[model samples]
Target: MNTLSSIDYIIFVLYFVLVASYGYYVFKKKKAQEHDSKAFFLAEGSLTWWAIGASLIASNISAEQFIGMSGEGFFVGTAVAAYEWIAAIALIIIAVWFMPVYLKNRIFTMPQFLKTRYNDSVALIMAIFWLFLYILVNLTSILYLGATAITGLVGDATAGTPEFQNILHLIMIGLAVFALIITLGGMKVIGYTDVIQVAVLIIGGLATTYLALTIVGDKLGVGNSAIAGFKALMNDSPEHFKMILPRPAATTGTINTPLNLDIQKWVVLPGIAMYFAGQWIVNLNYWGCNQYITQRALGADLKTARTGLIFAGMLKLMMPVIVMLPGIAAFVLHKHNALPGFSGSKDGAYSAILSFLPSGLKGLSIAALTAAIVASLAGKLNSISTIFTLDIFSKYIAKEKADEKKLVITGRYTVLVASILAILFTWNDLLGIGSEGGFTFIQKYTGFISPGVFAMFLLGMFWKRTTGTAAIVGVVLGFVLAIFFNNYAVGIFGKETWLYTAYTYETLGKDGLAHATTEIPFLINMGWSFVITVATMIGISLAGPKINPKAFMTDKALLKLDNRTIAMIVITLILLSALYVKFW
Candidate 1:
């Protein structure tokens, strides 16, 4: 069942050729302006509203969403959809408010924003942090998880087998090379080709989802119908359909004998607490502040940027259906003992669901997965290259008016170097992405920096009294508090506190024995960290000036919303409200 038919190979090959050919067409059309840094990195003004919108979604959805989020779906159910759902609202805010500021200020990169608002020191420090985070956490996980997912479809593979590991390496390298081809063509190529990539991603993903639901229905003795399969899932695994997880109950059992699986679930997603805490930070910082995402709209005029962002938000509404529902279906089937030889790893849920796909359709699904992985890889590599070439190299190494050709060449080299490093790190699973669950692993590590980065950006933009010193200190303090809350707070202050309660859960250790670990939920940690960091920053800034000398001039005109923008915003809100009302 894992093996692909000849028709499947033909479908996949055709897809590869179509994308490559289109990417080449885009590259050649823009070849004359490719040397311009803005054109190469941001695609400048070439991208239309639709291209920008599709590119935004393409860059954002990768192996992490397809595999990691689906894995989360298998384990935690609809609650995991919060990440995608909240992102819709976040994009709205960015379109209306954040996009105006960015476009008016002509900010091209995140570090550049820091340098303009605060000081050179703050900018330089963050540039380094972002570089490491992108390569180590974001890039590595995408490669490792994507390779793992595709390898599952290629053969009857078992985890930890020699054959499986060998296939994984080949897929990782192949993915890296494919991404490099797109990335070297620069941002125009990335943006335009992403239109096709997003199309394949959605179509193939929906095809897989439909089949998964039908399989579920057929397995439950109903006819092969997606609606029937969905009903069967809801009927069979009622607990998985909840939007919020309950708080962990007090545990009295030993580590191995009596497992608190509910507590483990709560640890990953801590109910209303997360809604009040890291949820906003995660969405806002990602959609508004991150270079990899915001770069899509940075090159456009104000109206175009706003429209593109709203378009992306609309697309986000359907993402959970494409990415998360299959895992839930897999859970229903696995619970019924319908999936033979399944390993029961949460990350394997997507692959197990793919077994239901017909021969030609199997190739289409793999193409979808490959599209997600390659688009994200190319996007991340471009961002890494942008930061290094523009933020670091332009300022430090060149220290003069650099030539456009040299800058473009430097950016390409950075992409190659970053891809190699990511592949090397992911080769051995050195980051333990598999153990932590891919979705949770990304959120946890990224949480360490989000509190600080979001705090800095928020205070810098709105609060003119916020000084450079406050910005620097806030960044450090946010990180420190996040670490304290995550690692040491429970041990120092006992499990129960007025602020938050730490929960104890047993997880299987490397020795194949359960071990009890106690910790405050990470989202709660991020929330408290943000609150305290903002307070400290405010106090420090109060001593500076009522309005800092470098404060950006603003006018009512900048925040004004057009009729079209307003219409889109209203539609997005209506859809978003209905979703939460039903799920909540």
Candidate 2:
């Protein structure tokens, strides 16, 4: 039966009450000064390693990871976990390479750092882009997908009844309101609440994993032991265990992937490209330059931040087992028709598996999803506010000594307005925006901006010759190129997007849908986009104006890395390499 029991309802109630109560208590305890942006936005830079560590995971481990990445596991298999594993390496890199420079500059927002490193125009452009990107892509997608998960677990979205519709809206609004409330307390509240949220996330997520494997074993008409069932799974559907995917030969025009999911859309399977080059661009853009993520590290001292990042890296190593295995279990169950409630969908795997949870644990599963959604929502809203307050409003509109009280008030107002806009976007999506492909569709669209952002940040940080004009040109050029690759590549390449690249696909007709199967993998496309942007930036920098590179400092002492940081970096690189080899 796809429903919650009375005890399940009780757990749900307690989950929200305790979470809200703890958040409010932290807010009341702090009573941060409204006149201080640092106090409001960063918890006065007084957070410890534990809080920073917890908050980093809480912020990063949102609907995107739980709902989206798990959806990917079902859609493309275990290779989807490259996003999580690659992030482990990226976190270590950020701790040692990025944080030292960021902390030295006392940077509040990424755009603020750009303002210092580049120009006001560059910073302002980046700021406005981020604000809308959060609203347009991140906010809407998280709310929609999280609500979709709630609907799958609690009710039916396609029931064609007013009661079902009301249930769905109520859940979506409830999640949004909870995130808004937590964000009202500022970073201190978010940081402390994350510690508890992450604990629930881990316990509930692990419980889901254990139960899923048990259900799979029973479905196979074997025993109900997770370990035994896992062995049975290897015996039955060994394809699910493959971490690397093969592409078709250059002469062959079509790839034959497992489950025969679109060969082109499933990008993580493109073997060496994904492991060596493509993943680095995507991970660095997300873990290093993404403001909401790096903001947590900014809240602590460098030592604490490094320790916390290492802790986060270690935790990430567990996610493939926790967050993804259940999805793979769902796929195996649905493919074999082993579960009565099974439905084949990109997002259906997680929800279909929820039907197997016994009463109270079902509540924990939903609580885990709720925790994921709200943690990310709160983190995003705060970043939106921070960027708007420091980079846009204060830098331009407000006077030099504009009242800090007013600035903080403006920050709160930004959060409120942004929360409302996000809700509206979600409502629009429910009516229909990306109702079909779910998480994967949203990710493909992000390639338009992510690579460019990565290119700008990577080069600007390392190459002092990158002038403001060149930065703008290169970034704008990147956008145009992404548009061509995603939308107009067919026209440019004459109905074959892979004439230049080695990938291959056949556009399939799907119930009159307008989208075409992408021949070029999204990550590979992003890697190419980054290369072109870097080339463009370098061409302009060298031809027009010559300047010394940032890494070309006369001080040889600056080249030295801390012994501890050096050790962490080495460990991170070695682990990442070993993972690829093992998976391959």
Candidate 2 is scored at a TM of 0.92
Instruction: List the lowest-lDDT window of 10 residues for candidate 1.
Output: 250-259
Q: After superposition, how far is residue 535 of candidate 2 from its true place, in Å?
A: 0.9
CA lDDT scores, all candidates in order: 0.91, 0.76
lDDT of 2: 0.76
lDDT top scorer = 1
Which candidate leads in TM-score?
1
lDDT of 1 by residue, 501-523 (tens): 88887777889897778878899
